[model samples]
Target: MKNELLQIGPVTIYGYGLMIALGILAAYMVVVHRAKSRRIDPSHISSLTIWSVLFGFIAAKLLYWITQWNNIIEDPRLLLELSGGFVVYGGIIGGILAGYVYCKKKNLNFLQSLDLFVPSIALAQGFGRIGCLLAGCCYGEETNHWLGITFHESHYAPNGVKLMPTQIFESVFSFALFFLLLYIAKRKKPDGFVASLYLLFYSLGRFVIEFYRGDIIRGSVGLFSTSQLIAVLVFLATCAILISRWIKSNRVSHT
Candidate 1:
């Protein structure tokens, strides 16, 4: 894996950072296009995006610090390290929370806003996972299969090992989910259905992916990894939301 993708005198570009930049740009474009279709104020989206980017970075860094609390206790300077160790779920949570607050303050329809962003979020995740691949951050376990990817002098994964290309697998899955969500959006089922389904599908996929994740920094409790625990909780929450919506619909129809 190569972190430094390109470099010139007094300037350098990192693979991970570049992928993230591209992902954000692509996601914002999708958001703007979708917002126009939904009749949402594009200016509101622009403002919310500023909040999302700020809070997402902070949350990602905060969670990473929490995961490495022991090291930080030993050396506080590690907290300022501007490279690697970010948790994707943390960023999503932070970004969503920021959006929620912004919507509330702006008196916007939360579910509709979610509908506009979920597909974009999925697309962004797909690209972000490719960044993980290039940085060798979220690597997969060893495998003897020819399809496995090998790295040399990676910052995280073991070098010279044929690992399951889990990053690529997750990237493909995210993209598939993105298309599915977008297609479902076209059907216009109900408010929040697409968003909830996005959460359910992503949580389930992430839970399974945790099994193949080679890194130990992901933190675990009992038999479940941190992300797995989150996935289970989010899955249950999504189920509750869907069931409640169904019950409400039934009651409204009966009335």
Candidate 2:
């Protein structure tokens, strides 16, 4: 896990930032391609992506800050650090809200927009997790089993220990999810179905994956970590939305 990809005197390129940048590029490409297929204007897609990503970063940092409030209060400088530590859940929440606002302002159908973008989100997540692997942030519990991967140089992960490659597992799952959702979309499914499925599937996967994660940065309460609790809530919310949609569809069909 090499955090510094390149350095020239005072300038240095970070692995996490580079991966995030690549993820954004990949997401933008997929979004624009899907938008064209759906007859959505490419310019609008660009604007939406730019705004969503900007707000996503802001929201992610804010949520991370909230989680580490005690540390911030003690040092006051941790808040200003430009290093790693941005919660994915926070970014998702912020991106949704930001997308909602943009869609409303542009008079676009929000759910449909979300459907078009959901698969790309999964693809981007897969790449982002790869970034986590490179930066050695979201590590997994130490294991002596054959599946365990060692990160000897990672500052965040324990050196010279066999740790579960949870980041790689998550990356693979996200990529698989992207394909699944993309197939669902090609079937011409309901507007919000893909987005709802993404929430349900990703939340459930993240909850299970959290068990293997060794990162101590994530806060926990009782029997679940912060991400696990959020995952449960997201799954429940998605279920409620799906139920409501089914009820509405039945009523409309009856009429």
Give a tens-digit lDDT track for model 1, residues 1-255. Answer: 798888898788988889889988999998998878778777898988889878988898888788778888999988778776777788888988999999999999878888888898899899999999889988998999887999996888999999989899899999999999988998867778888989999999999999988887777778987788889998998899899989999999999
- Assess candidate 2 and give its lDDT: 0.89
Local distance difference test, each candidate: 0.88, 0.89
**Which pairs, if any, clash in model 2?**
none
Worst 10 residues of 1 by lDDT: 79-88
Q: Model 2: runs farther than 4 Å from truth?
A: 8-10
lDDT of 2 by residue, 32-142 (tens): 888887899888898889888889888888888887888789999887785667889999989889999999999999999999888988998999999889888899999
